[model samples]
Target: MKVGVVDYDAGNLKSVQTALAYLGADQFVSADPEELLSADRLVFPGVGDASSAMRVLRSRGLDAVIREFVSRGDPVLGICLGSQIVLERSEEGNVDCLGIVPGASVRFPKERGLKVPHMGWNQVSYQAGHSLFRGIPQGTSFYFVHSYYTQPLRADLVLCESEYGEKFCCGLIAGNLAATQFHPEKSGEYGLKLLSNFLYWDPERNL
Candidate 1:
C-alpha cells in the first residue's frame, strides 16, 4: 500500500523514510495536501521545536491536510515531535496544535531529578490485543529523545506507558490514529516490527 510521510520541514524524515523503505513500503515524502490525501496511510514523524514545526505545517497547510486525513478515517501514525503536535496544545511553545487527539504536551518536570531530554532506550508497557503492538512483546524497549510527553485527555487513548522520573503516556491510539513518543525507526528489530505492523494495521478491525 502507498504510505505518505508528512514532510513539514521537521527533522527525522530520512530515518523514517529509510525504515519504511526497509519494510518495502511504497512511500513518498511530501507536504502537498493532495499528495498526502491520496495515500493509503500517513506517517507523521518529526524532531524539532514544536512551535517552529507548527509554523511550517500551517504555512504549508499540512496541518489541515493531516486533520483531513484523520477525519477521512485513514490510518495515521505519529512519531516523536509528530506525536506531540497532534495534541491540542504543547507547553514547549505554548502554542496550539493540530488537536487530532484531545490532549496537551507538557515538559518533563525538572523536580523529578531526571535528565531533561530523557534520551536512550526505555521499556514501553502496552495494552494487549492492539494491532500496533501486535507480535511485539509487552514492555519492549523503544528509542526516545524528548523533553515533553503527551497527556491525552482521555485515558483510554493511551496505548502504552513508560517510566523516566515518573510514568508517562508513551503511545496513543484513537480510532484511525495511532502515535508513539518513541522512535521505532531507531529502536532496532522491535522498532521495525512496530512499523511493519503499522503498515498492515486496519484501524477498523484493530481499534
Candidate 2:
C-alpha cells in the first residue's frame, strides 16, 4: 500500500520510513499536500516541540490537509510527538492541533517522581480491540521517548494506557484517526505487528 509519512520537519522520519518498509508497506514520504493526500495511509509522526512543529505544518498548509485527509476516512497513525498533535490543544503550543482526537497535551509530571521524557520500554494495558493493535498482544512492551502526554477529552476513545508517573493514555482511536504515545518503529517485533496491522487495516471489519 502507498503509506506516506507526513514530513513536517519533525523527528524520527527515517526510522518510521524504515519500519514501514520492513513491514512490507510500499511507503512514500512527502511534505507536499497532493502527495500526502493521495496515499492510501498517512503516517503523521513527529519528535520535537509542538508549537514549532505546528508552525512548520501551517507554513506548508499541512494542518488543514491532515484534517481533511482523516475526515475523508483515511487512516492516520501518529507516533510520539505525532500523537500529541491529534489533541484539541497543547500546553506546549499556542497553535491548536488537528483535533482529530478530542484532548489536550500536557507536560509529564517530573514532580510526580518520573522522568520528563519517558525513554524506555513500557507495557501497555490494551483496553479493547482496534485494528491498529490487532495482532499486538496485550501488555506488549513498546518503546517510548516523549515528554508531553495526551489527556483525551473524550476519555472513552482511549484504547490503551501505560504507566509512568501515572497511567496515561497511550493509544487513541477515534473514527479514522489512531495515535500512539510510543514509537512503534523502535518497539521491535511488537512494533512490527502494529505496523503490519496498519498495513492490512480494515476499519470496517474491525468495527
Q: Which one is best on lDDT?
A: 1
**TM-score, candidate number 2:** 0.95
- How far in Å is the alpha carbon of 191 misplaced in model 1? 0.5
Candidate 1: list runs displaced more than 4 Å: none
Model 2 Cα lDDT, one tens digit per residue, 1-207: 699899989976999999888877889889999888889888898899999998899999898778987878878888888888888888996669877778799888778777678999999987566667876778889999988888898777786899986789987878777888888889999898888887777665773
Instruction: Give the residue spans of candidate 2 off by over 4 A.
Output: none
Query: For each candidate, what is the lDDT?
Result: 0.93, 0.84
Cα-lDDT of candidate 2: 0.84
| TM accuracy, model 1 | 0.98
Query: Candidate 1 lDDT, tens digit per residue, 1-207?
Result: 899999998996999999999999999999898988899999999999999999999999999888887888889999999999999999997999988889999999998778889999999999788888888888889999999999999889998999997799998888898999999999999999999999998899883
Reference-based TM-score of each model: 0.98, 0.95
Q: What number of backbone clashes does candidate 2 have, counting pairs of residues 3 or more apart or in separate chains?
A: 0
Q: Please estimate how well model 1 matches the true structure, expressed as its whole-model Cα lDDT.
A: 0.93
